[model samples]
Target: MRLDDLPLPDTPAARAALEVARRFHSPAFVNHGVRSYLWAAAAARSEGLAVDDELLFVSAALHDLGLEPAFDSHTLPFEEAGGLVAWVFAAGAGWTEERRDRAAAIIVAHMADAVDPAVDAEGYLLEIATALDISGRNPEAWDAEFRAEVLEAYPRLDLVGEFTGCIVDQAERKPGSTAAAAVAAGLPARLAANPLQL
Candidate 1:
């Protein structure tokens, strides 16, 4: 789906985020990211959670908007920039302190090697989100074993699995304006090209 069609805030944070996306980014990341949000929305509804589709969508939008100038070149990740975008969103969108804190916590824990006890934070949500987006055909494929391993740590495996499969299936079919149809179209093949193994 087009970014415009996403439910994210149409405020400064959203505008600033689009400006950043225009600089340098991956179409695969964007497409799958949207696809992921769709699944997450489903999962949220299944839980009777009132996740702001727009808020979650905005969070997903800026999930990795901080890539290097070369788009995928740098290793450090635009961490500070990611925070800035989140800050902008919290302020511009008038989010509650709990919500802002949740986003900040999630972003901070996202890249950590170990899951913390304090939260069912962003890292966990993002894993579910990103997995829903890109866990293409053969999720049983060895290449994605690490993700499977990680999912094992979640309290909602069966639920995540349900929507994740849907994400892969949807990604395979072409329906609307994706970031680059060809990119996600090639994902299953690329994922199938190699299996993950520990």
Candidate 2:
């Protein structure tokens, strides 16, 4: 798989979602979001998953929106808050009610331990893609050349330091959150040891 081989959805909703990611997230996060879409599309190709490109792209672009201060929730986990944001965005994009629910579900499932592709292909793809981006989990899942291309194009910047702080803050503030469990299970160390080498 190569960078050019990956599908980049160019729908109005997809473009607007990417713009929202750029407007709200830091550059590192924006890059991560974009990279996540590429990775997901690559995985879909490899696994023969027939995902809706526009839906996957939109979900990927806004998956981390709750981490932004403007959308951060005091009582809910970041993923949940981000899902609400996506739900609203989907409505504004003129998606059907069911489609809006699917978008929100995909955003929330990215933080889940796993998602069944048979049930939700988009969610499954987003989960694996985000895991790859954040922790370099299963780098073998993607072509090495493609991985290098994404890194070269996006540049990791200070993602490790920045994301570590974000998750840590979420953990401290919401002890029952998935972020808290991840932190308790040595997420920081895992992030530091990520094999991406970017």
Candidate 3:
């Protein structure tokens, strides 16, 4: 489905999160964020899972906030920093403490190897969505037409190259970081394993 045609939550909190993410992240990261949400939402629907749209939208929109130079923290891994940023944004948007925490948790867990849907539905969906975008896992889950439309709406802008570079930079700058671990575990191999044909 086209990005424009996809259903996005129109709540005030969702809008605020998107604005903050767009303001902080680069164009490429912003597109990645949006695609993450679209893919996650579609996956959720396919699985017949009930999702909190506002939480999912906020979590997905701000998932990469740490990649933004303004928010990048030398002390924390990008995932953790992004989660903190999302938590703060959600709190400021008048989200309840529980909701804010949930959003933060979802962002923090996106980097995990697996997210158990029974434990955290939003996180599981986000994980799958990001996996699909970054690693092309379950490419069959999204048909050719849907993939084509998403790409047409939000051109890649060399996402694999740019994102890989970002992760490598993080690894070099913060050896103790999750990005560093990913690099140590063979990021190049992972990227090759999940090639984006487009």
- The estimated TM-scores of all candidates read 0.47, 0.98, 0.91
Model 1 worst lDDT window (10 residues)? 151-160
Best candidate according to TM-score = 2
Clashing pairs for model 2 are none
Candidate 3 minimal-lDDT segment of 10 residues: 189-198
Candidate 1 ranges with C-alpha deviation above 4 Å: 1-24, 70-81, 92-100, 109-123, 135-198
Tens digits of per-residue lDDT for model 1, 121-180: 334555455543343323442224334433333223232333334334433442431312
Q: Which ranking of candidates, highest lDDT first?
A: 2, 3, 1
lDDT of each: 0.46, 0.92, 0.84
TM-score of 3: 0.91
Which whole-number lDDT from 0 to 100 does residue 18 have in model 2? 89
In candidate 2, where is summed lDDT lowest over 10 consecutive residues? 189-198
Q: Write the per-residue lDDT of candidate 2 for residues 1-198, one digit (tens) a residue.
A: 889887678899999998999999889999999999999999999999898999999999999999889999999999999999999999999999999999999999999999999999999999999999887899998989999999999887888988999999999999999999999988888888888754
Tell me which of candidates 1 and 3 scores higher on lDDT.
Answer: 3
